[model samples]
Target: MTHSLEEHGTEREGPLSLQEIDEIIGTENPPLRNLRITYAYHQLAVALARLLDDRNATWCGFGTWASRTAGLFIRGELKPRPVGLPPVPPWVSRHLMTWAAPHVGSNVARGNLLVFQELGPLFHTMVTAYTEEDDAERALERVLQPLRPGLVTEGGQDLLIAAARSYHRAMPLPHSAARSQVILLANLQVALHEQIRLQEAIAASLAPPLRAPFTPAPLNVLATRFWGRLATSHLMDVYMPAVDFTTTRTLIPLRLGRDVGGAHGATTFCEHLTDLIDLELKALLYDFDRSPNSVLGSAAADWSLLAERMNYLTDFFRLWQQDPCLMQAPFTPRQAEDLRAGKMPSGPPL
Candidate 1:
């Protein structure tokens, strides 16, 4: 749906600047900007994966120079288009750029995490190679090269970071009841991580001389702490209900017990109990699946474990509402009276 709303997804010939991003992507809003950033991270991940697979790069050490412009290319370009997944719009330009302020800010936070959590470890694991390394230029190349074939082209990464420079500008919270409500809720959770990067950027930009006893790397450390706090906050805090509210509301189901008389009460009870039991069993299985990886630290490995869990649930829940055999109770007399006469009865199920 968003393919055309973009201006460009190319790499700059030289070091990236924010204006170039605004120009290339027409920095108007969130989705367009996020698409750019997400593309960049996806590219980085692939580049690292390639390095991880390389013999010379085995000891960690990859950087921007390794890759170059390929733009929003996907796995299959020539063959007949695949059937299922929604194709990226042919040109994602237009007012979509307006969504960038918040989207870019959010992804930038995650991008920082990807860099520190994933890339930094590669360096640590392969530190011996890093210590002996000389050509900083080659080091950057080595890092970025593997990503050459993936989704983000060199130009694209440059453009995204460039566009992201305007992130400090706030997304004018829309006055519309629908949009503002979402922003107010999402801001609470998202702000914590986003602030992490800002603090670090400021500290580094103003950091003192050659060797002062460091208090910490400002932005990243704060990011680390903020993430710690986020685990305790409920998911409702982190994402706007409206983001996936349609899907979520469908998944949770509504059972108006009071309205739906006693005739079907036993049926509903059995169904809810069965669904919960199944859910518990699924959770247990995933818990076990993660056990082996507890001691093994690799993104691919961790992703594989989590992916299995995600895939399993995605399928299980997709059909849960339409589940053929599941039983549910019918309406009670008062509920039926309200329904027949047309009254908005309160509670989940009707």
Candidate 2:
């Protein structure tokens, strides 16, 4: 039977008053602190998205976020719910949300997915300062901290924001593309880890590989709980088409391509970076659909890696969807050819 948060009960619209949002999803959930934090970020995201000129795009992000929240509180599906979120620009938020819509599920992974979207992929960035073990998550805390609101901010060691007095300036905020790129890439990294965890759980549960670790038994029918949260960052190709690492003469530490050669330069090299996404997804599907060699063929695994891979792929595409930079690719192949042979940005003809 199909279930939906919107259909489950009589839903209420806000002015929910802070207490209401808090009470419905309150500490009754595990990872309670994080869920409260996610809801808080969603509130901030809603307010911020309203400020953008492109309201539809902004609304997209907010809607996905709210739906995810409702899903968590209602708790029907199997995926984990998100706890807290970092600030994400409305446009990027829209793209990521759209890309991920198909992958959304209830329960555990959903929550984890949202947090992964809000926070970028530096899953292992050491959280300390000055080599003091006692510092505890300080370095990580700083990175996770939202950007300061101002013209110019420092990221240390020659990294400067160059200030934006207005949004119309040549460069867009890193918060949009940068955040999406980091988050998507980070999710990829963690998927492998989560896969391992699932593997462990599967091994312990039964020797037969064909069975799904989770089935009809619903969780949060189990929350009374809440929980949580990288960066190769391929999304730069999607967001920043004109200004690139090679063009700007900067060494960006991203792992978007395979072997950094051939046609797969960055995700944005093609329209929508669809090729890169398709490739990754195909590989994932192969794993999910194909079975590993076994001496005793004890029923191949069911739930396919496709489920989780699609989840990450959805997030990746969402970031690409909302990028204003992606709205215009600087030059087409013919234009590049003409320019290489000496031509203007307009070139000879279409």
Candidate 3:
């Protein structure tokens, strides 16, 4: 089925106003709604590009960080680290990335890169505007000139939806339903775990002065959470409906099977992630009584929290880099040899 921006509450006349965009985002359903949010962010990024000096080293560093960070979610590269690392839990196998489609991954990575390159600055501007007692609407409109061409055309939207569906169809089929669920869950968990690690790394790489600009105010924090929810929802609610059935059937039994109890049993990684996303949404979009935190006080908190994890993992990977081992199993002999010789693998493993 074809989807249009109009179906998700955007008007065709000229450009979308902030109110209209908010209403659409507030009321629309998943996948399409998620796509709309992405479209909005892309617009914001464009606006940010117009406002920021591209030649500034700090800005360039931020772009590089954003591109690399986006890669964690889109590229699906398996780390060289052995399984059972902090993010790579015991349940995750080293060969998980083998199941991913490199072409699809590359397309997704490119799409993500387009939006992420300016996202940090976009958020910074929004929050800064709020703090400065500026005309928030005017400031936002200046950055988001919706009259211009959007990042995703209708054809591009169709392609994205189609790509997501293709990724779902290509999911591996194992001998039993249980095995299939395990593989699916493992892939999801590993992707998210690795993403968190990458976030930590990106946050750490920025010097305090450089990172200060990216520090978000309460409004931007809410915006960040909203963007995150929409992104994840695009995968779970829109792209991977099959996940719902699998999660329903497997979650309880899987926990019981492992005899998992206490706080951990209360929620799985996906569940906890979803809950946090929802909580942030509720606080930002719905909660009227929520007290706003000080911008500077909490400015560094988010980055610090993200940076805390993956330190050991970071150190381990750095150590492994000194004497890299030959790629094995999934890699062909030639590919393995090239890797050992410090060359990029020449072609697809297949």
Candidate 4:
């Protein structure tokens, strides 16, 4: 029997809070009706990340929670797949296909290449210290000394900024469908760069000598898991959906909700997206389970928090389908001006 949300769990309480809604649509002309749902999934991602860090869980525990959370997410129910839809344009199909296909392989390979090209000597230094019976702490410090800030600088933060400039170039809105492709791609580029910053921060937080057993092995393991999680969760849950939403929205106008063909076409466009995302999640979980960090033990009580977060994210997806504007809210005038001027608003102090 197909499970309904009410039957299995509580009714959908969406991700965004009332205050956030106010921020999205200011007081002057409040949305005729408040959104029943909020952007809960993004919140969940942030919360889960905080838990991982604040708890300072072991590498194994971190790996396990990530894998399981992704697993439950993969197995969760999505909106019913649409049937009898007309075909999308070849360009749209091809673009969606690229988004669905696995990209982690090339990305991970590039990461390894960077390690060898830039960090090879650093690793060599550590190995030599081990062989020479030198102090592991001192060796690790020497290796990490030059790498932290260098990782942030050479690693594409600047490239991301340069790429955002392309987004500011005015494009014809009449061709919004096609233009959206460029816009979404540029945004994903920036998001990926942000992911790089996250990965770097994770690496930097490790005090080589202080953490002790100063070896590259555990660090390498952590790096692999970190990249895997980012690629799977971010690409699957956020990027692909954003692309699908844009493509479908551009091709099939939201006002055509009552038009059978238009609705079906939109549904078809999003139909396989979740499945594609789940495929990647499964692959990620499998890789994590096979890694040395996967331990044989009971899951922490915090696992429930992960489950709850996944539900929030899932519900957010449903809420977003009902109203895409929630996730793709229009940029305010000041925000647009800032973007055009190539000035990023500063994030809150860390």
Candidate 5:
């Protein structure tokens, strides 16, 4: 049997008052109660996507609702009921009541997805701070306490503890050799610990990953939740193109006749620094997809390594940004032009 927002009896449009939104979702029908609650979550996600785009969106309030509701959902105690939301942005409110559309269960999932996106900025800041400090417990509390409230539902109290465990499982202190010097890299490691917590909360709300018919792709769903746009634009606009000019046309055609040790030298360098960057981005996408349900898997370990690599790469990229000339890598002199290419060397010379 198919269920929908209208069949659940919600008013499509009029005013964006939370009260009106409240009414569309509030009801005594036991059979439709869950559907109503999920619909409310969907509308809220749509509203939030609009607000986040505004430079003046009220994040603190959004954080409050997200934290409390996230806590509720995590604890499995979320009631299909109205929420005491902070006042909606006047412009947003003005149009919300006039808003009407077909809705689906995935909207609720998208709402949860938006919560992930909305929380990202705060997450970045918190992770930065968490990684710098040596004391784990103190750092965890310093960050966690601010978000904690008396109303955090079931199992919410244990989230930080679980994340901390995952952090240690993946990243033991005293730092790995690869992670020792770079603070940015270290910060990413610390940040993942917190990300684990957020992922856990979301996953608890969306288990087994159900997909509604004609729903958006998972990456698109996540991207839109955060940026209200597609992933391609988000990545391309924000990230520099992955290219390694040092190795550009580094490969040469030799009919056993081309001058030996000439041009790119006898050494055949088939790889470019860009390849590493692309690999990292791919790894990141993989991690993002897995993060939803990765409380216990090898995700912690994978993130730990990726964070270290990202740190080093970030520094490398930033250095190039400061002085573009810094990226002109000198070609290595190879002794013999062997036809068979060997294993691509790992780790940048940086």
Candidate 6:
């Protein structure tokens, strides 16, 4: 079922208060709560989208995809909706409510707060700093310091500094506009990281086998997450699209691509693609678990498909992690065009 804020006929000008959020969500019924949480994420995604500048193709592409994907979830369907798949099962809805909804609600609230409260003021300051052409470095350092605290090593600092210097250099934005976009982009990266964590948490919670004893994630996984977060946060033109909530079915033409010229390149590419696929698998497993015959046909066929997909994703993650590339660079226009044409640059086929 769909939930729309417009149904309440209330003005959508500012963030909804806690009481207002509750009223919109209405009952604690599992399915309804799940839908409301989905709606909340949708609102969060839209807020992020609005912050994106069209002059930056990478950021805009990611924002557009994220907003669209969240919109589809509100309808209980994935992008490029499967032809005859039934609605989400009842038990899955219950699981979503129990394991995912609360975190999603809180995260969305946090994201909104960050956008309006923290980032909003910083953005304004950045604009002013740029306009004066003084104290810009100090202003940027203030925004960057909090994102990765102790983890940003000397090398990482160099990357960040380089990123700041070259940020939006290819674009024609004025100084104030460029600086403001940088601030927004940095915070947006942090917010998106929260979204990815929520997705991983939901997947693990729903899939019993994945719920192993809590240990630190493998180094490669940790590395990928770190660099992915850092690149988007500091590099103006670098943006990783939020993970897809479901299968691609048919590959949509991607407008951005990268060249994997060496071992590091291949590792980075796989790390990125694997994260996307893992999230997609989560949605597939949700639909597959205890599904009715009408929804996905026989149990055997469904299990087979799920197993195959999981195995492929697992293999990629394993092999790529062996040679982890902890740094991610922004994509150039030519590299992005190569991706658009489905060229592998130099790595294994995606």
Best by lDDT: 6
For candidate 1, write residues 56-76 as lDDT tens digits. 111111122111111111111
Error of 4 at 86 (Å): 42
Better of 2 and 4 by TM-score: 2
Per-residue CA lDDT of model 3 for 201-260, tens digit only, reads 333222121123665687556544432222221211111111122123111111111111
lDDT of 3 at 52: 31
Q: Provide the RMSD of all predictions against the true structure, rounded to 1 decimal.
A: 24.5, 21.3, 24.1, 23.0, 24.4, 18.5
TM-score of each: 0.20, 0.26, 0.23, 0.25, 0.22, 0.28
Cα lDDT for residue 339, candidate 1: 29
For 29-81, candidate 5 gives per-residue lDDT tens digits of 32233323323333332232222211111222123222323322323332221
Q: Score candidate 4 by TM-score against the native.
A: 0.25
Q: For candidate 6, lDDT tens digit of each residue in 1-350?
A: 02122322212423323443444344333333333333333333333223333222222223323332332333233222112212434454345344433433343333333223332333333333344445656655654553332222221233233233333231234424333334333323333332333443322222222224565568545433333222212110211221121122222222111211222223232222223322323343344324211112211211112332222222222222222120111122343234333342322212
The TM-score of predicted model 2 comes to 0.26
lDDT of 6 at 321: 23
Runs in model 4 deviating more than 4 A are: 1-152, 155-157, 202-325, 328-350
Name the candidate that leads on TM-score: 6
Q: Give the TM-score of candidate 3.
A: 0.23
> In candidate 4, what are the lDDT values of residues 95-211, reduced to their tens digit?
432342323323322322232233223323333443344564454455344443323456534424322332322122232323333333333333334335445432322212122
Sorting all predicted structures by TM-score, with the top scorer first, yields 6, 2, 4, 3, 5, 1
Q: Per-residue lDDT for 1-350 in model 2, tens only?
A: 02221221112211213343334333444333333333333333233232322211222222233333333333322222121123544455345433333232222333443443322222111112212334433533443344343322122211111111111121132434333333233333334333343443222221221234564445422111110010012111111222232233222221221112111233332232233433333454345322211111211122223343334333333333343322121234344333233333243211
Q: Model 6 compared with the native: what TM-score?
A: 0.28
Instruction: Report backbone clashes per prediction.
Output: 42, 27, 0, 6, 4, 1
lDDT of 5 at 115: 40
